[model samples]
Target chain A: MDDEQQEKQHLANDGRQMTLIDQIIRNKVFNCRYWKEDCFGLTAVTLVDKACKLDCVGATYSGTGKPVPFLCLLMKLLQINPDKEIIIEFLKSKDYKYISALAMFYIRLTSKPKEAYPTIEQFYADFRKIRIRNLDGTFAIWHMDELAEKLLSEEIIFGISLPRFQKRWILEELGQLEPRKSVLEEELQNQEQEQVQVAEQQNQEKDQEQGQEQ
Target chain B: SDDGKQKLNDEDTLDETEYALWKIRELKRIKQFNDEKNKYEIEKAEIDRRRNLTDMQRIQEDFKLGSDKTKMEDKTKYV
Candidate 1:
């Protein structure tokens, strides 16, 4: 065999050795009481299991669906833990678009319909503002980042901690739509006022009956 | 004969009242069910719409990136 061919074979063997070393290190790092094997990886499995435990502990006093949002929020919050290198490694393998979509789904799913729906619209609007370089040498708009950031941030409904850039983007998006938010608040206030009026009328009738009896 | 006729008329009135009440309750139950079904249908449609939009967006991006290569080659040849 040629000298070059022998060298190549030796390099390939070294590469295989390094891979084995990496696997051994990973196994040692993850084979702990807190770390559990999951579909995605050890860290994701551990986080989900921990979240499920928290869910069970809190479920005794509340209804089922109500705790889902909080659990989801907690999962996102857990991602921000400084020791989550494994989780971060798994997330890095995901495409940005896919990651953003999943984040948006999580955010929306965990949020209240009344609050989350408007935020969803806002996310779409922000997505419309993303400029991409089109093939025709023209700029086109995309909203994937904006949507992702909005989902990541804790500002809209569930106060979940996201990465810094995502939080900033969400804040900027929310700032742009402050007027619409105020209008929604005003409408909610008006509805509450009407409810109070109806309740007062019923109370007044009861008071009048008691006065007549006396 | 007059007393029997009156008794028959009273019995018919009672039957009509019972039938009307039962019909009203049935209609209400049907309406409630329809409302709940419509809500689920609306939610399903919204989810479908979002999925379609996402798919179209991805396709549009792929088309833009893919077709641009041919256009670039054409420009290079013309130049």
Candidate 2:
């Protein structure tokens, strides 16, 4: 084969081996489960579709026109349905990292707008109340750290200061207490000891029964 | 003999054109197939990544429960 034919064959081979990262990105772009049917969700899907097309056409951006950050897109979604079933569905998806990333983007965007700064406290409060439902419709709560980074970033960007009481309450209620630091540690240890004792007693009883048999 | 040679050359040129056109069509087909495969792969990878994150979160929760059980034991002994 000529050099041109050889080059074409190599390109074809390379195309066949699509990487894992590419697949993950494509799923995010093409899949609708990450978004709801509301305005924010629709907008996000549209923006993503545009991004996919742009990527396909081999267009380069100067970074000035990058689509709204993922978090902003999510916030738009939240605005459309602050407490909708679709929100929980999106959260339940394995793509929580993308969702978290989008949450941070919204926090930053809102913080930057002077008018939106006043709403930060209320947003934080509402966020604390956000509960996700599993596929079976069971409610599942997410951790504070899942929220803290974005909340802190929003606070920093907006210059909105939360009350000390509000901060303490959220920290105490939402933060994941370390295993060693939890008050339940002693109780758990005692249970383990009791279990061991029960097992020993059962063994002794078995031994006596065997002796009787002998 | 010269006329026969000319006719053979024409046939050779026609064959080359046909071959080139076939190759071009094949390349287009390959490109379309790759595009679709890439799209599916991207969606699957995203789903798997999310699943892994959920699993990790569950494991962490189980560890927390185990620790809580230990703590309860310690408290009961002290009381």
Candidate 3:
């Protein structure tokens, strides 16, 4: 009983860690049923298992704004403060999209402007569909590219007030970030090359016809 | 419909919290169903539009158009 009463070693610094989530939202997550049961004592490893089961991404739902399982797991992540490598692994994984989204949401909430923009912009080419649970308990489909765009630009997503980061244009002006290249740049270049080739072929055909006539 | 409810087995010993989670998932499943239905309606509308038929002509061509989820019956719904 005495040992059980002792705070877990990993949770010793939770006071500082708890500041990651907003005060009101943190209280909601702590009081939520999912937090009490599913998120109890979850470490970084077990959290991955929970994240894989998530089908939709949102902070809360049902008009009442009950905290969703995704939000609870996010709060658990804030409490645990997993290593950067783990968070990166979650971001880079292609198999579990919800896990990647969870990582993205965490990065948007916690990372500095320098880190967040470049990290999120890399996923702009991912056009896969994602299920989003709206605040009214309705489901809406959003593409991964759309989610990435919103994360970089939108002030509020999923019901949480994101930490304000410097605008991307400002960062680019300071030469802190490279101007983001569009995914269609290569395709457009290929189309231009094809057009040039077609024009050259027409010129060659005309030259051949003129030579034949001469 | 209550068809979304899963039948429990004797081996399944879920507490109230776990059951609540299941209920939430059930609600999400119903929402997913509606989204799927809406997507089908949108795709069907796109195909119908591509067929180059006027709205009134489309309704006349297909008897089931009255029951269509695309709301062509309302006339102004889509515009």
Candidate 4:
């Protein structure tokens, strides 16, 4: 809730129509300290232009495992709705493997197997050298060539689960990933539903008694 | 002094009106706060529903490839 965050909140409150992903990025990305850099002062307005200039060098937020700003850029790309060929062109590039991986993540999530798989297939060899995160909790680099192969093959790999990668975290944070709800949540939902039912039944019973009296 | 007295006389009737205006303003403030609190709670609950991690845990389930939560739960118990 600093001044910059407040500004983004104002921008969001301005009643501009955005896609769900844009809204998600708008709310969450500025909170990460990664974009707090002198160069990367971001808003929904400048988010796309600044993100296009992003490189792998000095792109990470060291205090946490999540790279919130960079992922916000990736989400911006997805929100823009470019052609499949344009994204395929991105995957073929040699530089900015982190952004490339994000493109891959987006494709794998959004596209059909018939479309996404073949496009990602040839790039597996190229992506082999791209390291995203390690096997442990730390953000120390792990070569993500295997991850690319799995994604191309449509396998789920565990990510570091940080507040960085604001899209994934927000998706998981918003409980859109129905597969991951904890047991406690299910229990609470059930309990609340039952309580509502019981309250409704009691109201009906009271109404019946009042009718009989009348 | 006559003008000042006239102003004071003008102000004397305004206090009752002022009291009602202040009450309306306070009511609006309370309604605004309640609305914001309700919105905050709903948004927070939505986030909580989607979150898989707690502040104390570091290990995460690899929820990729349509894996079962029970099996992932067994594996992620380390964190």
Which lDDT values do the candidates have, in the order given?
0.38, 0.36, 0.72, 0.47
TM-score of chain B of 1: 0.48
Query: Model 2 — TM-score against the truth?
Result: 0.23
Give candidate 3 regions above 4 Å deviation: A1-17, A192-214, B1-79
Alpha-carbon shift of residue B57 in model 4 (angstroms): 52
Off by over 4 Å in 1: A1-183, B1-79
**Where does model 4 sit among the CAPRI classes?**
incorrect
Candidate 4 C-alpha RMSD relative to the actual structure:
27.3
- Cand. 2 Cα-lDDT: 0.36
Give the better candidate number (1 or 3) by TM-score.
Answer: 3
* Model 4 complex DockQ against the native: 0.01
Q: Cα lDDT for residue A33, model 2? A: 31
lDDT of 1 at A214: 100
Which candidate do you rate higher for lDDT, 1 or 3?
Answer: 3
> With candidate 1 superimposed using the best TM-score fit, by how many Å does residue A135's alpha carbon deviate from the native?
25
TM-score (all chains, Cα) for each model: 0.20, 0.23, 0.62, 0.35
For model 3, residues A1-103, the per-residue Cα lDDT tens digits are 1212222443464435556556677677777888888888888998999999887777877755688788888877877778889999999888788899899
Q: lDDT tens digits, residues B6-75, model 4? A: 3322112225555455345444434553575568679888778558576334224334434646676687
Instruction: Give the runs in model 2 whose Cα sits over 4 Å from its true position.
Output: A1-67, A103-147, A150-154, A157-165, A170-214, B1-79
The top-ranked prediction according to TM-score is 3
Q: What is the fnat score of candidate 2?
A: 0.00
